[model samples]
Target: MTLNKDHIGGLIFLTIAVVYGYFAHDIRMFPGDQFEPFNAQTLPIALAWAGGLISLVMLATAGRSAEPKPTLVNLDFMLVGKLMVLVWLFAQALSWIGFLAATILFLLVGYWLLGERRIRTLLLASIPFAVGFWLLLAKVLDIYLAPGKLWQLVLGA
Candidate 1:
């Protein structure tokens, strides 16, 4: 079978997903049950395995598909650079800006950089994403993301 861009891309993604799952599976579990019938780490482990399995299926399906011409690996330097800078900023500000505010800032910056137009659209899209992401990490995950010094001093983290 001829290996095209689709097949190769799928294969790489699958491999990375499997590797991520493997590492996640190796972490030590927390002692004592915080929630009934479920430990803190259970969902993460389940998600990792599911991701790995999905990737495997994707790779298998791509391998069996019809081949197309390979496309050149052109990097979108501007987008990549912007994303990287934003990610770095997020990491640096995580301990200072709290979860919700930092998430909103990142989402807004990301949306604008990715060519999203309309102030209303950007505002609408960012709100849910920031709130949902914060809720997921803080509540469902039962993990405390750094609420930042400002939040800590104000809200008492």
Candidate 2:
């Protein structure tokens, strides 16, 4: 049997899911801290299980197709590289600019890079998302997010 992309991708996905699930399962929770129904490990574990199941289905159906394999020439390596660089920059900026500011910048730049040229739309989308997510984490979830070193220095807070 010929090994197709699906087979390889399925195996990789399944392996990642298993590893992620394993690590997620090892998360430690504080004693008597049961305010929330879901803990830190909940989302990761759920996503890992979902990914593993989908990967298993892909692996099972991979050998049933006899169609001609598609070439990789259509894949845009430059776009992928740009996205990778953006992700790295976002990670670095998170500590420097904090979550809300970094996320807003990331979303704006990411949308622009992906061909969304409307400034109004970008502002409408990114600002609400950044603020909503910040509120969700900080207010609703009672999580503490850094207000950024730059903001701290500038505002003298």
Candidate 3:
């Protein structure tokens, strides 16, 4: 039997699902919490089973039809490398620049890298997203966010 892309993808997804299910099943519940309605492992195990079932359906349907094979294209390594670097820089800047500023900058740079040339649109989209996320996590949720080293230095806070 010839292995098609769908078959290969299904096998890979199946493997991942099995691994996820195994880990999820092995998660230890707290003492006297065995009868609880929900636990940490519940959702993960359910998702793993769902993924496994979907994978089985995919594998079973593979090569059943005479569909044309899709053409493959060469990957752009330079673009991939740039995205990797961008992610690394974003991680590094997260603490130093704080969540709000760093997220806005990251989104702006990401949009630019993905061929967004309009400054007004970029700012309009990114600023609100960053500010909203900050407000949601920090203000509404009462989660602590780093004030940023730069802000601390500038404001002496």
Candidate 4:
């Protein structure tokens, strides 16, 4: 059978879903939290299942599609690679810098990598969004996020 965009997309989606599910299964739970209706691992595991199901359905129904085969000639693979590296760095930064600082740096650098150069525009775009998201996760959701290793060492937080 000839592969089309749908088939490729489905395969990629399936791979991501499976990987996500695998990690979700490893999530640690607090004592007695497993018996609760929802816990730390609940949403991730549920999303993984949903993603897997959707991807499987996508693959099953991807027998044929009108969409043209994706072209690689114009693809900016260097940018993609940079973005991937950025993501890795962000993960590393999370442990060292803490959630808020790491997030702020990630968003700012991500915007810059995507070609946003204006100083005001970059700050305007990244800062508020990062702060707001941090607030949402820490305040609204009451999720405890560490401030960062830098802050702890410098400010003795």
Candidate 2 lDDT, tens digit per residue, 1-157?
Answer: 6778888888899999999999988888787544678878778889999999999999999888554455688798898899999999999988888999999999999999899999999999899999999999999999999888888888989
lDDT of 1 at 121: 89
- Which ranges in model 4 have alpha carbons more than 4 Å from their true place? 1-71
Clashes of each: 0, 0, 0, 2
Which residue pairs in candidate 4 collide? Answer: 97-148, 98-148
User: lDDT: which candidate is best?
Assistant: 4
**Candidate 3: clashing pairs of residues:** none
- Which candidate model has the greater lDDT, 3 or 4? 4
Model 2 — which ten-residue stretch has the worst lDDT? Answer: 63-72
Q: What is the C-alpha lDDT of each candidate?
A: 0.79, 0.89, 0.88, 0.90
Evaluate residue 22 in candidate 1 and report its C-alpha lDDT on the 0 to 100 scale: 76
lDDT of 3 by residue, 54-137 (tens): 999988998784544544578777777888899999888888989888899999988988889998989998999999999999
Better of 2 and 4 by lDDT: 4
Ranking by TM-score: 2, 4, 3, 1
Q: Sorted by lDDT, highest first, which candidate order results?
A: 4, 2, 3, 1
lDDT, candidate 4, 1-157, per-residue tens: 7788988999999999999999998999889999999999899988999999999998898886686677789889999999999999999999889888888888889999999999999898888998999899999999999877888899887
Q: Candidate 3: TM-score?
A: 0.53
lDDT (Cα, 0-100) at 57 in candidate 3:
96
Give the clash count for model 4: 2
TM-score of each: 0.47, 0.55, 0.53, 0.54
**Stretches > 4 Å off in candidate 3:** 1-73
